[model samples]
Target: MPNSEFSGCRWAVVLLVMAAASPSWAAPIEQSDTPLPADCDGLKKLSLPLEDAPPASMASSLKGCSSEDLYFGIGVPKDPVRARQCAYVERQDPDNGWPNLFAGTGMLMTIYANGIGAPRNFDIAMKFACELGGAPAEEEGWLAHLQKLKNENWQGQDFSPCDDITSGAAMGFCEAHGAKLASAARKAKLADITAHWPSAERKAFAALEKAKNTYAAAVADNEVDMSGTARGALSIAAREAEDEQFLATLEKVISGNLPSVSPPDLAETDNKLNALYSKIQKKKDTSDWGTVTKAGIKKTERTWLIYRDAFVSFAKRNFPSVAPESLKRVLTEDRIKSLENFGN
Candidate 1:
């Protein structure tokens, strides 16, 4: 992969919505040119440091509880109040690193702008937006946009922070928020499903989880075309889909629902896969494969081969009655489908 794509993935891996509150409506506040207070009185009004401000603790704590998940109803009920409180606490803390600060500020902007927990307050939203400090022109764009909405008496429920995203970086930030929510939900589900397994099974499950995650990462990095502006978001979506599929497959495995295969079937699938790969290799010179080069395809295939072997080894220990060739057949068939796309 190119260095730019790698950097984009790093930006995505490291980075990590709204509703109405009351039935009664209030007229939008008039836009003001008033200079924002140095201390940001809006934040102070919340009486933040809602608890003792532990140095460098808010980010990890918020992630653990998944403030976004709660607010957006990803895996749990929507609780904008809880989400607002969590983000507000972090927003007040000056000791946080830049990334966390940016994240907290963005969350608060969404909450206030949408009237999710508190009353819709575009002034407060603009306050948070000003702190975002993107490029000067971008910052001006945000302020102007928010100011127009406020002046026009726009309803908070009608707008979202993401609706105005124009740049790739900003779109990436928005998409990453969603990916985090999905990941949090996925983690909660896997934990619930495996909570009562025997110790040895649990150990094997952990190994399986690690292997799948590694393979998922490889697919995101190597399989997806990263030449577009949406590459970061695209990669994130692909990785999340891979994880969901892995979880679904695991559930099916535990239920013994995967089709059993004979040794001859395995041999046939292996031969088909080898022939398809060679055909794909031949098409590399003439076909439009987008961002995925022939070399990248080979690397991804190698990674999948390793993952298949690891999975088969795990299945041998845990399911001794299951034939090894059956496992190989299933994985090889899936790989064949993916490789066939290259030829198409």
Candidate 2:
């Protein structure tokens, strides 16, 4: 990533001057890697009487093996059984003083729903998504949406064929196809419309748009399986690879390397960041948090922002920490999770 790209982040004139004084790449690893504990088989062999164990006992049993950390943009790459067990423990003790178990459940479910660490399964995803009574109950119009995929497929990308929405694999495969197709089409449309966009974000828009297409092109050959986590990983890898261009460009600009710094584009992204921050606030305002206070939301978000900005340079320098969009995505997601599960 370039130094000039850093300008897109939140900044005041003074900070900009200071940042310019010593522009450098920085990355922060969220958690230390640890050895994986008992797999599903090992977990089953535990003679600790799981079935009859009370919720507290179960929760106590999983201690020291429940950290939900992962790399910057990977979300929680949970151990399938550990994540499942995490949910089970939480479900058994939903009223724990610290609902972190439920938090772990939500993380695992997110991975399951998206097929991040394992093959995607709609039923399992829904099972996890609905754990907190926050997701919509099964209803009509749902299957209709999943079945709509039969009519679309990225123009020519061999989207996996699916005939039954009842199958989690089919539903997930179709949804992934539709979403990717829609994303590609949307980018094409944006490219055409950018000619009319205000000049400030025009160049930046073009860069990002091109970056996205480059990413798509890189993965164009392989058959994209939306029902599995590999495809998602590919997307992340491609995007991270391309975002480096932004940093590369930024680096030149910071050292007076580029012809001009284009304050307009910086303003544009800044506006977007602020808007997203406010959006989270609005979501918090309306969400029901049982006993958790809105102050928790504010405090957590602020801490996240601090942590996020601190590593901007390092992330730009490193290939995988996170891009700007990834940073916002994780933060927004973490905020929403907090709202949904207060103790999280």
Candidate 3:
């Protein structure tokens, strides 16, 4: 891979400032090597995982990968060197079923694109992205665009696909792409767990999934204010969390490890929620309410109540022994926390 940092300087700025007096190519600026082929052969030339490594599916490519964790600083200090090393190790692994090759290469793309631990190299980043592949026409079109730039001998640094992500909508789209990758892993695991279920059970699970999705959408739209640029990203993040929680709750149910609660416990939680709701409604004129108004709070509470009932109904279908009251209590407690944290 190209190791030159000479291209990292503000060469474009310098040229622009002197453009009126000097010719377009007057400066002896170094040109990047011709764009690499957007193919596995070009990917291998980067010397990352291997030269002969086979292409892998993009599904579940980012789930539970060390490179992802290191690069994103999830539960550990971010270390770009280790991140790159882990990515290389993952890609070279013989097991294609696990999220390995694409995960590694994808992380490398992010690392180079963002200059996490090295000079930003869009050339290397583009090469990594091409290896991921996509619908044939779209993939070819993207490569063609890049090739055009190379052929024209564009003096400016090559652009990464992520270069123009300046707004919430753009970031949200980026997160949506990542969510699709992560969702693949969750779907795979769910399939494995439910492979032996009866038709009735499968049908019930489908209903539960539909209910969960409805509730998730409600939560994203109602719980989070949509007035800011990050609203898109924030709303997506909320829905993603709901997806994860759905899978996790199912796993717990299958394992018979779901917590149990009694009627009294449910009543107490409901009482607390009611008290908090009344207080907030009466204090709507206070500055402590922040951006949320009394009407909005009422609407959110109504939405939450519907979600709580749907959750309980779903839980009862899959795990009859599990108390519906327990689910209600837990959901109410979650609402309580959300209310308590309003001004904090």
Candidate 4:
């Protein structure tokens, strides 16, 4: 497999939304007339660490909770789940066409071809890799690997019944538990990392903290021009790009400080959402639609996507200067809870 097998079989998504009660916004890090460290090396000089990570844990440092394993366990090399997932994430940014950037989809295809967590299917792997855009060399290698897995007659696996949380009450409880657990985990993680920080990186650590504080202040000051235009979008994109870089620096430093800490699996959050969505489909599929057209189910899904995008976009306009991924995530998390539990 070139990198598509889902280890822990769970994915992680990081939505960086500004959380503030105030409506004022501003540029947190004042860009110097002399462009300060734009790349990791430059940023490293600034004492800020950064790493290239895959989006949504598709092939990532971020881990997802698995109902099967019940947890996205640590110990990457030893853990079957972690090893498989880590395989999906390649370290070659130059090959991916994005300088210093990891290819999210390319890694996924690798997993499929290698049969990391799922079945070894060359056709499926190639299909996904093509969709994700790729370097041809990866595809050829993946093809060969899939053939190898096939020769061994490697079997595939699916999520066990325990992995599927169908009950509304159960899922809801799980979400609450997840939220609480995440909060504690984050606090502990931050404390643990800081405690272990070496003196050489103290300046870098302070800079990172200042960046975080300023970003928070900016998010709070949201009283900015909400005009939606190409120019505004570009401006937002620029700032968001900076924010992403700042975040990457933080990730790198933390990894440096504490090599043992693993990214979250976020199974609780995902399971609830997946179950609710599945229930909706099952209900629609088995429904006695009466006057409602059978096409309504799929239409509803499509419409929901459109609505979600628009709604998030609008909410994001208020800030117009930061990434709305976090807002989208919060909204998404809330939505699963609000969804009509068909299984109930």
Candidate number achieving the greatest lDDT relative to the actual structure: 1
Number of the candidate with higher lDDT, 1 or 3: 1
TM-scores for all candidates: the values are 0.65, 0.24, 0.51, 0.21
lDDT of 3 by residue, 117-158 (tens): 545555655565565433345345445545555566544432
Residue-by-residue lDDT tens digits, candidate 2, 81-114: 5554554444444342121212343344344433
lDDT of 1: 0.63
Model 4 Cα lDDT, one tens digit per residue, 1-344: 21111212111112222111111122222212342322223322221011212245463343432211212222122243443344234332223222111123333343444454444444444333334322234333434444444455556432111122222222222233333334344445666666765664554455445544454233212211223222222223323433444344344433333122111323555566777767766664533322333244344444434444553453344234434444344434644543443334
Tell me which of candidates 2 and 3 scores higher on TM-score.
Answer: 3
Please list the C-alpha lDDT of all candidates, in the order they appear.
0.63, 0.35, 0.55, 0.36
lDDT order, best first, reads 1, 3, 4, 2
> Model 3 residue 61 lDDT?
52
What TM-score number comes out for model 3?
Answer: 0.51
The model with the greatest TM-score is: 1
lDDT of 3: 0.55
State which candidate, 2 or 3, has the greater lDDT. Answer: 3
Q: Give lDDT: candidate 4, residue 340.
A: 41
